[model samples]
Target: MSSSDRLLLILHIGFAIFTLGPLTAATMATPRFIRNQNLVVVRYLNRTTRIYGIGTLGIFLFGLFLASGDFAKPWLSASMTLFIVALVLLLIVERDQRKAAHLLETAAAKAAPAASSTKTGGEGAEEGEKAEKAKAAKPAAPGADIAQVERGRIAAMSGVVALLWLVVLVLMVWNG
Candidate 1:
């Protein structure tokens, strides 16, 4: 391999290791934070996923440079296809993360007033009894269920993306 190809290979590997590792970690961890209703951590993970996800494009670009227009190789083609699919899935994951965060935030906002009212103990005994019954019949907040559904989707999609990355890694090592 020439010096430029060597350099490209290094860059490609670097981006893969640095970006994919964190991206996978963030996506995997997001569901847990969402389940916990930790908005701050969820936002941080969302940012991490976005940044690292974009960084992964560097890996693809460098790999293309290393390929030097050799698009006919089966392994290269398959790897590229898998990478693209993974990217699409990651995009969906990103969207789901945003939605989950928004839902959780809204739930928190709505719950705050209800929480304050309950704490003040301003209601009559009958009213308090009725309120407690209503709270028991329902979840802590509206949209919490939807947020949980989003969490499940994010987890499943992140898993698939991680699997794709593993498959691509195997193809590169075995076929290169």
Candidate 2:
């Protein structure tokens, strides 16, 4: 591999790990927590998408350089295909989460004025705000309703990616 190719591969691997790390971390959270409109999942997924998408794109670009020379093998092709698939899956999952997050935030914002206005504009205001926050703090209901469906798919996506990278590791070591 050329210096650029090797550099791209290293960068891509770093991106892959960063991309998948949120997935693993969010999965460790409860399903309701993962799907909640709290923005935690949204931020995590968005970051995951940006890093993984940009990183793998760089890899794909560099793959052109690699393929022009000594690295254009069948295994490399398969690995590339797998990598593309993984990126697509990650994007899909993150998109859904983003949609859900935006929707929920909007709803909460809408409810906020009404909720706050209801207070008597004194200690009641403080109490009402506290209550509203408490309401928000509680995890949103869990289901595959929106993002949950994509969240469910995350494991399969992660598993396939793990398998893909396993093949990559094997080929890299064995010169396949």
Each prediction's TM-score against the native?
0.86, 0.63
lDDT score of model 1?
0.89
- Report the lDDT of model 2 for residue 67: 65
TM-score of 1: 0.86
Model 2 backbone overlap count: 0
Say which candidate scores most in TM-score: 1
1-176 per-residue lDDT for model 2 (tens digits): 67876787677556546644554444334234445555565666556555555655665565555466655587777667776776676566556556656655666676668766766776787787787787667643432244556456654655565566566657655763
| Cα lDDT for residue 53, candidate 1 | 91
lDDT of 1 by residue, 1-176 (tens): 99988999999999999999999999999998897788899999999989999999999999999999999999999999999999999999999999998988888787767755764345565676687677656555644565878899999999999999999999999998
For model 2, the stretches where C-alpha displacement exceeds 4 angstroms are 1-33, 69-72, 117-130, 140-146, 154-159
Give Cα distance to truth, residue 107, candidate 1, Å. Answer: 0.2
